[model samples]
Target: MGEVIRVAVVGKGGSGKSTVAGTLSRLVARQGRKTLALDSDPMPGLALSLGLGHITEPMLTAAVEKDLNGRWQLKKGIGGARAVSQFSIEGPDGVRFLQFGKADELGLGTMFASVSGFGQVVHRIAEDGVLSDWSIIGDLSAGTRQTAYDWAPYADTYLVVVEPTWKSVLTGRRIVRLAEQRGAEHIHLIANKIESNGDLDVIEERMDLAARCVISRDPMVTTADAAGVALIDHAPESSAVASIASLAEGLEGD
Candidate 1:
């Protein structure tokens, strides 16, 4: 592993972006690096994928407060590094987790404080310089909203995970265009859930870009998802996990 890995996993809903984000974080941590897994989705998916399993409370809720202007902001003295140490939940392989509060029946209104706080922390970490050695893998909300909003300032690379579906391809295309607009140094289309030999080709042709990595459509992945278990824990030897591991290796070398 050479340079630190800072990437955001983005894609259409159900394209397995969370799986890639969580698995990649753990893989990088296993290599003796401090990895931070960020889940920006209000309805989180990374917690389960990271094997933390259904974190009921928002991790950053305590790290934010309403200032005199009545807006949410990170509390004084809680910078990025301290936020990670105090607020981030530890997962398997020493991967640290942070997420926006989950939206319940009341919706995102109840979680605005945590959302604002998390956003501040993300921005702070990118500029902090102290956490430069940390590997950051953020799983942005599915689709292009996060990319358009620049939620991942820390990512030099954007891993746009695309499945072999027309809808997914279009979403990935939009994200790629957005990332490019944001001046991302490296934007790679990761072909996920490939079932047949031509699956990768379909995605590449539709997107008009070569996939940097291809993950097979392993049945074990579906099973694990249904059971709400992490793919690496449920099927460590599965081909999909192996592909993700290889993806981690390639990113580490870069």
Candidate 2:
């Protein structure tokens, strides 16, 4: 086995992509696999969903960029090697959380310059012989352009999350095409908020994507979000959590 399996969850906004990504991180970590969930959404939804409210710092990619461009040095003694360690927060389930802070006008130039360096860091993290030996799961923004430009190079598998709606399905197709163009190895689909099995069939037929799993709508998930807790921790027995666990298992198989 390699050091880590890098997975990126991407979909249209409001398609429950971050929820699934957060749940998948917890589920994978619970299986004794060290996991690092990177919130690349820029909106900071994953942190709230994962119950990590105290993480005020930005992710290593953005922070390091800020440092390199002379904006601000986040860590005092940390360099590239200690980059991941500095930004990642230890979760109760042993999953490390890294959230990319919102980009501002001044931060964008530094971010672009830091892209290559960030790629190197991600490669080192994903390659064998690391101490942490954790899988990297990223919750990226909804669009295909951002997924391709910002995340695809680092991800081994791109999990295209979609709902039963027409807009979501179309976005899934666009994501699949963009991921393929970006040289992603495997692209998987996980339909969320499904009301019925027929919806899954329709999505598969319409999008012609391999539906790995379908996560049903759960009121417990809503309640957990309202209460500001991770769905996996708040409602482990919920159908949505179970479905995310199944998705994690499938990714492990791959």
Candidate 3:
């Protein structure tokens, strides 16, 4: 409703959530909209997927500290979200990339602490309008489990990516419910890997999916992943990239 909007790409593991989030943000940025892309997944890959290579610093370790009680706390109080902009890495197509946290050899405890602490970061930016001046897109962690950490409040709109698989549909359905329960302003389904028109029909039969856009399976995505480049840059003419760009173009002036 303002100059900026927050959109989150969420789904089960291997649903191409990062791909959709990365390319969609790129397109949005190319349309002259200032955009910031945040990777909230513990195992983040949006940087490489977005053609920005890898970001070495994770958001958790970047903004938090351990207290004497051995509890993780925000190092900078409520200003943490605003500070994220100061340190964001430059991403392709004018979109800045930030991270929630990444765990390389870190144990689950540290990862969960990041999860909990990042909930504060998300809530700060989401509701406080810290990032409201720019189009904020988040690549959320796999599964609906993020809802447990109060993460659903971060997005005004939820783009649930569903592959043409039974497990994907079931998981997407759960995500839809969680998004609704958390009071998301809008919920849209984006169907991926649509090899044929029947795939949409099959998905529709299993669930009432009002798909916002159907992205067909394109090998360019695989090629881009293999070569470590953004598909928008590697294969701009690819059907997948073109369709997603069109979708982002429509959002201009909204």
Clashes of each: 0, 0, 0
Encode model 2's per-residue lDDT on 1-254: one tens digit a residue.
Answer: 32357789899988888888888887777778877787766565787667675355534654443445665443355443466676567886788876555555227755554443444455555453353566878888877767657553457788898889999999999998988887788899888888888989888988897688888878988898788788877888999988887777778767
Candidate with maximal TM-score = 1
Model 3: residue 114 alpha-carbon error in angstroms:
4.5
| Model 3, span 96-150: residue lDDT tens | 8777557774567767666656766767775676655688888888999885455
Q: Which ranges of candidate 1 are over 4 A from the true structure?
A: 105-109
| Candidate 2 C-alpha RMSD relative to the actual structure | 4.0
- Worst lDDT run of 10 residues, candidate 3, spans 245-254
lDDT of 1 by residue, 72-177 (tens): 8888899999998999889999999988787872246558878888999999998887588899999999889999999999899999999998999999999999
Whole-model alpha-carbon lDDT for candidate 2 = 0.73
How does model 2 score by TM-score? 0.82
Give the Cα lDDT of each candidate. Answer: 0.90, 0.73, 0.77
Tell me the spans in candidate 3 whose CA falls farther than 4 Å from its real position. 1-3, 60-62, 77-81, 105-117, 251-254
TM-score for each model: 0.96, 0.82, 0.89
